[model samples]
Target: MNLSRPLLLASNSPRRKELLASLGLTFEVRVKEVSEDFPDTLKREEVAEFLASHKADAYKEDLQEEALITADTIVCLDDKILNKPASAEEAYAMLRALSGQTHEVITGVCVLMKEGKTVFHDSTTVYFKELTDAEINYYIQHYKPFDKAGAYGIQEWIGMIGIEKIEGTYFNVVGLPVQKLYENLVQLKIVV
Candidate 1:
């Protein structure tokens, strides 16, 4: 259902934009530069929501009638957060650590309105098949997933062959927990 007010998505991720579009909601992409930094004291599960909340804070004064949406995603292994890789080598190392292991993908979403704000998160367990050294190298060179958390994309080639299983929402692994986001939007009356 169309909303009474405009929807503003404060993210530059094409994946997130596409996911929101798939829900049949009309929105405007209003990019804002928000740092991904979080307190070192924050737990792995809390980091994403903290960051997403910060993203919303950056535009709190500008929320006229537009409901704003922001999100953050992270990959966790053994309680350690794996953010986007800065280099191909880092991506390879992150992927190697994930090989044959079950890791967690968490995404935090924030929906802010002039009246109130909602912040929440969803996590998924991803199991990867044992990957050969050559396979890791080839994937890094071919897919260039340095921008994605966990050094990989669940919808990309590495995910198709490397990811053995997932225990939660697949879209959460892709960077946005769209199902939960949709539910929150409806609850907040952003969509009918």
Candidate 2:
């Protein structure tokens, strides 16, 4: 596909930008603050996907003839959704809650086409080994993963030393599901 249309990424996440760059696709970043709130009635995955689609809708007017990509990721453990922490204390609390447990990292992506077509969402499971107070404290103090969901980055020291296993895409835990995004892009003929 030799498309000349530009691609727009509607997010301020550096990780998502870097992940998309890895695909060698030319794109421009357009960050718009959208409410991340979702109805409490929605389940875990539905909540995530709903937010993602809502983000995409915020950029609809700016889409032009290009495809716009928007996404939302959440960490779920025992039906609880863990988003980015509001403070250092919250971050610490989230990490402590995740210690020695398996969690689901669900990423909802909305790829909006120029012709009004769209596709979205993917989920990955990650497991963390039991972490001591020292381990969690050290990681919180050092990494300070305030911008990441679940208060941790899978590519950081915590994941290196604390994650025991993962059942799905590693990139999904990082932020975006590149493989799934690529497949959808291909189907949309957005990239060769």
Candidate 3:
């Protein structure tokens, strides 16, 4: 947790906070409202990075000695991006679409300091077993994953039983790519 500068995490997600803390990094949590909207022309794979960097841009002038970290996660099913669900029906629909299908979970992170900035991303391919209506309903009622992208948490009950395999880092699906982020922190000399 020896950081060269004060570390600031700009996200309200508990998962992101937990993941970052798991790295044994001492940091402060800070969040600012930023628009999640992206241009339609942006490639689906790039949306996460775009949003992450957009969030970091907000504090370009505000940041000084502290290294600001911002992250954005998205669940992509082919050409579609499954964002956080707004309602139970939406959550059910997203989970149903994910049933027995392979999707990509992309998490983009931006680290900004007064010296410079670094933006990167990590992608994980997740395979889900065919989920039943009952299972989906049960999870929705119990977990209420409305705050999570793709209507599910890979660390939750649904993910425990539903995820069959993953081709990349498991933490990416949980909302942060700690391995990659850790490497970036070291490279940036934030972690000494």
Best by lDDT: 3
Q: What are the Cα lDDT values of the candidates?
A: 0.92, 0.89, 0.93
lDDT of 2: 0.89
Instruction: Answer with 1 or 2, whichever has the higher lDDT.
Output: 1
* Poorly placed runs, candidate 3 (over 4 Å): none
- Clash counts per candidate, in order, are 0, 0, 0
Better of 2 and 3 by TM-score: 3
Across 87-183, the per-residue lDDT of candidate 1 in tens digits comes to 9989999999999999999999999998988999999999999999998999999999988998999999899999989999999999899989988
Candidate 2, residue 103: lDDT = 93
**Residue 98 miss distance in model 2 (angstroms):** 0.5
Can you write out model 2's per-residue Cα lDDT over 1-192, one digit (the tens) per residue? Answer: 344578889989889999998888889898888999999999888987899899888877766788888999999998999989988899989999999899999999888865775656788889899999999889989998999999999999999999999999999999899999998888887886
TM-score of structure candidate 1: 0.98
TM-score of each: 0.98, 0.96, 0.98
Better of 1 and 2 by TM-score: 1
